[model samples]
Target: MGLRLLIIVALFLVVEIYAYQAVRTLFKPKWLLISYALISLFLLVYIVYSFMQFDRAVGQTQHTMFVMGLMLLVYLPKIVITVILLGEDVFRLGASLVNYLMYNLPKNELMPERRKFVSQLALGLAAVPFLSLLYGIFEGKYNFKVIKQTVFFPDLPDAFDGFKITQISDVHSGSFDNHEKINYAIDLINDQETDMILFTGDIVNTHATEMHPWLNTFNRIKKYKYGKFAVLGNHDYGEYVTWPSQKAKDDNFKGIKNLYGQIGFDLLLNEHRFIEKDGQKLALVGVENWGKNFKQAGDLNKAALGVNQNDFKILMSHDPSHWEYEIKEHPKNFHLTFSGHTHGMQFGIEIPGVFKWSVAEYIYKQWAGLYENKGRYVYVNRGFGYHAYPGRVGIMPEITVIELKKGSNVG
Candidate 1:
């Protein structure tokens, strides 16, 4: 903790210095300087106060929201200024070296002071991201988008051809601040009107009480013909918080599972349920939370107990890493897998076919959208809600509608 604080302070000082240089270079008026100083001092105080109260504020949605806004609006702009200025310094150093080598310039004459235009340019570039983040907080956070995809499978049952499944994941209810916006999101899911609904976990951040407030809103979600099913994510296990006793923790877990029931979802814990249509059965398997570094309570084999080897199977696992590490090459040959833990890091550039990238891609091989290997498939939902970051940027919250088509060459 001490080391982390030192690093944060050091970074803050560097960023502020760069910000000061940029502002001072552009404007020399005493009034302007005084205004800048006061703004900087207030931001610095807020940053320190946020850090000092982090432990107490983290669990409180409103407090954390304020801190996150400060980070995006103030701290992020300073960091961007620092990066732009650092890049400018690198070019300046190269210019100095070139002057010495080519013209045999004296030490005093070799290097010139940073250009005022360079500082102006740095500040200008930094404003782009700062303004974008501000917009993200206000609008992008609630910008729920529906991503439609079609996956073809040779082994898919003809009776279930063109079966539409709506998927949502990572509803960290603890972090939600707006009830009306959440209700709007739920209404959007109902608008899809898919045959089945799959929730790939993280219903709450840590405890069951977080979900109590949203119960009525979620319970109003329109029922699907095939039914709604869900699996636990790492956050659902209450492992991130301290408990007074083991029984208290157990009680919390029970409440979380019961909340799913209240919301009209069948909670699957290493279990399999058959969704039948026209006398043809497609197995839906769901396993508990399992990730490379997170909780690994999920048992795929147990979930597949009654499922046949050739049955058209859909597995609901929280983390995409589970598909990367276990499910993709498993003997069972799950036709389609749904996951939602990535949330695309809630920030990234995703322009369909043109470009798709996120910091989460480095961590989870199958971070978001559809991934195929041989004949198997997995659709990773970006998530239904935001988490620690409070708001999303380029990667908006997602509601995935997958239409499963039978046979090849069917576009």
Candidate 2:
């Protein structure tokens, strides 16, 4: 996760840096210098803290310093955004221009005469935490989103036109302390005129014991016709948390699987199930964590057992890389696959044309939207819940409704 975060922050800094460069000519480079210096300081602290976070055995010295460092960076955006919007839109805009400069260039002690900028820098840094707190408010309610694509197979019958499949992925159950906030998300999904509901992995975090409290919240989900199904994410097994005995870990996996069953979902561990209506069967194959970086234990060949290759198939794998690395080149092409590991770096622009260039581009070409490989379709969901960061800036929580239309050509 450290490497993942490093990649994400690096991506964010790249955009922020370039955005700063665009406005450099407009602001005093000295102000730009100070503002830039502030950003570098934050980034340096962030990098140090990040390293501290990744090194578990580094004792509290590095951990404490690192965490304290990250605590400030997390709030810097709020400060930047707030300062840019103060009193009037223009003044705030000016602040924003300055803030970008600060983030791009860390200007300190370079010039003896530029001492007046220190007050603005200090003031800006002071608002970081408050800005982050304000940013949290943006996540309180339902946000309208654009579903990038609707996949279709030639054999799909007309009965399933605009078939809405609400997909939620990366719900790290252990991360949630408040059930009401979770219910809000669930209510959002239930209220949608969705056809079937599918959760693509990470149903629970670690031991099954961590999931007992939130069963009621997840069970509140309601919708139109088809039932619910899910597969295992990388965190499903309790690997991060140490157990007294290996048996404890084994029992945790068992309990988590039972919890999945309890939540009214079919835990598809490298297996296929058919969702049929009006005598037309649509094959849905789900495999346990088949990511390029995470776990590669699931077998797509076994998942497709007894299911004919000619049938219209929709696969549910966790990460987008799986589709790129495995499914797209499989012997039998899956018409559509739903995945949600990207969460869109949880905070990058995903507006189709431009979203492709973001950091997510370097990793998964089809990070948080839809892509077609050869002729097959894959939808990378933007996740239902947030993780370690606890907030989303660009790629919001997604409630996907896939509309499947019958195609005349089945070849």
Scored by lDDT, the top model is 1
Tell me the tens digit of each residue's lDDT in model 1 across 170-286. 999988888989999998899996899999999998789999999999998888899999999998888876677899889999999888888999999999999999999999999
TM-score of each: 0.94, 0.70
- What are the runs in model 2 whose C-alpha is more than 4 Å off? 1-149, 351-358, 407-411
Each prediction's Cα lDDT score? Answer: 0.88, 0.68
Worst 10 residues of 2 by lDDT: 109-118
**Candidate 2 local lDDT, 1-411, one digit each (tens):** 779878866755554553343334336658776787587667656665665456332222324433543654443553453344232345545655676666553344222232234435544555654454345324521243535345666667566666778888887676565666677778777777777888888766565765688888877776347788888877776666557788877887889888878888889999999888877777889988877878787789999998887887889998878888889888888888889877676555555465344466777777877777667888888877655555565567777877776663322
Candidate 2 vs. true structure, TM-score: 0.70
